[model samples]
Target: MTAVLNAKTVNYYPANAGWTNMWTAFDPVRINTDLAKAAALGADTVRVIVFPQTFGYPTPSATYTARLAQFIGLADTNGLDVKLTLFDWWSNYTDIDNSVIWALSVLHPYVDDPRVITVELKNEISPGDATAMAWARQLIPAIRATLPAMPLTLTVDGTSGAPGLTSLKSQLATTPPDYYDFHFYGPSERSLAEIRRAQAAVAPAPLVIGETGLSTVSTSEGEQGAYLARVYRAAQVAGIGSVAPWTFNDFAAGAIPANSSVSTQPAQYKYGLHRTDGTAKFAATVVNGAWTSATTPNSILNLGFEAPTANSPWRQYLPQAGAAAITTDLPRTGLQSARFTGTTRTGSGLPSLLTSPITPVQAGQSWHAEAFARGAAATGITELALSWFDINGAWISQHTSNRLPTGTTTWTLLTVDAVAPAGAAGVQLHLKSGDNTGTVWFDDVALT
Candidate 1:
């Protein structure tokens, strides 16, 4: 077999009980919610873990198998492929045969499933574990014999840098995998260069960065977003097979035991793209932006309001002297849409516009903003606005169009086009509503 992965991926690290409590009592609701969050982040693939002890070791339990199947089904429903890692955090070096039996028993069910992108033998097995390596050497062949077309991978800890990759290659010479999986948690440039070298050294075998992320300990939330954007861009340039960040949500306090191996690392707890309460961090925007840019190469971030969360970059402006509120309801497409409702005010706050962050634009270039909107008892005009900014963050000018007259209660596509100024550095899109005492709903807002 050949190595395979969805174009975009992220590690499905839970913000709740995490790996320690995952199998103690299976919670399908939590798993489904996490997968949905991942999907909302524009991830098409997720790296999941399945512990040996939880699966009944030598002979996998039927209950465990059923749950695993269901979990994969959930992921599939969210349009995600699974890179299932087996025997996570287990180091029973002497149980080599049992490990082989475990691999065979667990893998046979997913042998023909396309959703199972790859089956990892273990999670970050240490080079010092000669017994574990021996077990893997034997188990790989056994698994390959049974499922000849399955994509296989071995995740090696890359903390030691290039030397670690060399050591991993030497240790796994007996049964080389189709893909070389490694983890990196360093500067984007350094990680990029290291991945380039690793790819050269492990030619013919694709490389996947299984885990990489920045913690809020030393880096600010904004810096985390910038770092992820840089790393994602670098990975795209280097042609890496996939880049799965450390986690999806930050673990809550007391979620992990104080004595656990990962407890000492406070940074690990803050690595999630979302907080424990489901609020998104700035890193979510950067990741979503990078994924959208890489896959669609044209779509703007959060255009459809599909990622309905408070931390989104879309801003809702309320009238200074009148009542106004923004919400997600009655979407034109996807789960949610931006709805603005209130009494119209006069003066500077008469018409309010929901604006987007400054998006890079080129001078003399033409761009378009489109949205579907509906109005109920609205006596004011609803329109889309585009604003230009210079390189020094100075506002250049603005343009508005796609006006929907009052009393338009049906979904209507509103579009406007603008040419960037001579010194334009970026452009901002907005959903604007004229001073009216009614409700206006917007959805599927897109810019290109």
Candidate 2:
């Protein structure tokens, strides 16, 4: 049989070069140039920041909205999607103050725009503080009631305190946005695992890695880019919907005060894909490479990890291997299911499977299963058998079919039911490969 494409849309973040100038002064040429570049770079979405101070925060003036609309118009004209970042009160953004209502006033128009997919309320709200949450609550409702179109979101910094997985649940619960915006730095696989586990706490809600980079800003640009690619690809296999690196352009000398003391040299600008003079660094290349990847280093999909406690399991995937890492664990104990992985770990060779096993499901009881499978060397097909076993070890019935997609090193998610089964002690998910050499890696087995 032919290989299934398993092709998904990619969300890209390029440099919004003119965004800084928008704060105090709006430059048409600078803004247009940046937008044009983003469009040319194959980006489906561009994140735009609206600093409150420069745009007259807390006082809805027509001028601020007009200036923003001009940029939105440009984006629409270029056929690029927008992920409008609102109320960026970072250090340079201090003048914007913290008035979500004012943010709403200036941002509501774009939220209704067809080009926008989501509204990023705040950059990184201080952990344990409800500032971003408060803002989201006030804004989403107003926008939903007035001009509801795309989803509303707030990006969280570092899982709300290494407070671990459930740390941000409070914010999400208090004011539910459409997706969970999370960030990560460093190269620890354990931390990435924790981030994946924490995703369960906000089950059902989509998760996006808004920022990622080397923890230490002093690292060489080449090392930063390579590490960034590794982590970003890991994130993709681990089932993150989108991953946007910190910034696209290089940081200007002394442009940021906090880090100014860290590096005095001109080329030492930290956490950028490119240098100030538009020198594309190694990190930029890594991001570009990972953005288009469908597989990882280990290339095996093990579907035997913990299940997602979140309401939505389809939106998230458990941790797989890094772009260069590998694993072979499966979901063999809990949830009574098994997952199989293929060996062709790359963007081109992903293997897929389908299964049929009848199981009794109960109403109001949520049960979910997730798989991380790699693709085969070439295109092929497979059917899986999902069956229920009685205490006597006999097959009772079939649950799902046997037609799976095909790809290599790609981490794809297959979800059945979020509600638990009725009168069934255990369930099994078995895969039948289409060919002898078709290998797919699997991990992050979840059944809840």
Candidate 3:
């Protein structure tokens, strides 16, 4: 068996530049520094991406080609292998000749280079697109013809998962590459099962989890590390050939290209293991733990939400345009409080929120949860809920507390005391708002 390849996707855009400015603003110092960091984490390989349009397409410019070579050379200096992903931001599938010429131009220099461990033909190929599949099938053999010794592969995007790989395998069964790259972004608990399904999709051929990560935009830094710990352990147990996290560093605000859909979401920018300031996140420490066979420190669930890592993750649902946020207006004890504002509820439920999710529990064990909340111009009723979830992270049912004060109240106590129902493995301290116009502030939440 090949040694388990541990890699980090280093296709990160620095603070002010996006993919469009890659070559024009190529910073070798930044890239080299990041590569050294990855090596320090004990990763044997580092993945990089190349956008077709960014480099002059079918005909590459001398400067662009030189910059790419420089990147690989720097990786070699750091004693790390490279997985170069091509056709990053390209989609014109009609011109197969153009694709082949461009791929040939890109692979010519790295044909027999030892540092280039694998060449991923495309970033993520859509199985449903007939034109794209046709484009990929023809391009695979042409690349194999020139770079016979090199291992060639392609990744099915995380959105598609196993089903996408199954579809692609059915379409390109005859002319497949040496292996496959499966981008898995499913829940941590489902990692093993999902990987098994993906492996079965492309049986005889090997598979690697090319990308998996949880962004801190919606989760806490501690939870992000927990996610990596679980998934990487699952990968090791499943005996997959390789595994790599999605991003090495988070993108700064407005760093992603404005034209892409990712630019619209706030969560997309914070996926990196390193913050834009060059400091590492909790996930980076988890990477070190996994690579070195050391036990990762447990994630401290700071129910008070006051610690540096703030272990709880609070999310809003059925939100207004800008309904919910963490603010410093009136914190019960700490520097921050969660605010949820809404008009009237249109759906069956109120504009509610779920937070401090998934603490393990026994079947019939008694539990208590409490949070201090204040209402401003509040109406209707406020209820605290203990939402139960099964072992697979599936919601079962929720037990609501008796109604709290309805009208505007100062820092009132909301509580839920209940026994875990049968088949309950975990629970979330849920905060459900009123159905009518009002605003709520929550702080000092605890579940025990």
Choose the strongest candidate by lDDT: 3
Residue ranges of candidate 1 with Cα displaced over 4 Å = 1-6, 257-259, 295-448
What number of backbone clashes does candidate 1 have, counting pairs of residues 3 or more apart or in separate chains?
A: 0
Q: Where is model 3 more than 4 Å wrong at Cα? A: 1-11, 297-448
Worst 10 residues of 1 by lDDT: 293-302
RMSD of each: 11.7, 15.3, 6.3
State how far residue 188 of model 1 sits from its true place (Å). 2.0
| Candidate 3 minimal-lDDT segment of 10 residues | 1-10
Measured against the true structure, the TM-scores of the candidates, in listed sequence, are: 0.64, 0.55, 0.71
Residue 35 Cα positional deviation in candidate 2, in Å, after optimal superposition: 3.2
Candidate 3 per-residue lDDT over residues 1-448, each given as its tens digit: 1532444434444555556655568899988888898889877787777888888877988888999899889889998888888898789999999999999998899887888888888888888999999998999999989998877788777889888999988888878877888887877644665777788999988888888888888777877776676667667767774668767788887678788887898988787888888899877877877776644333334455555634444456567522456678888997977777664564556666664433335579798888888888877657788877775678889888766576788998888889988877556666777564677787887776
- Error (Å) of candidate 2 at residue 331 is 44
Local lDDT at 165 for model 2: 29
Candidate 1: give the clashing pairs: none
Error of 2 at 144 (Å): 2.2
lDDT of 1 by residue, 10-103 (tens): 7765577777466555688988988898898888888778888767878988988888888889899999988889888788878777877888
Model 1 scores a C-alpha lDDT of 0.72
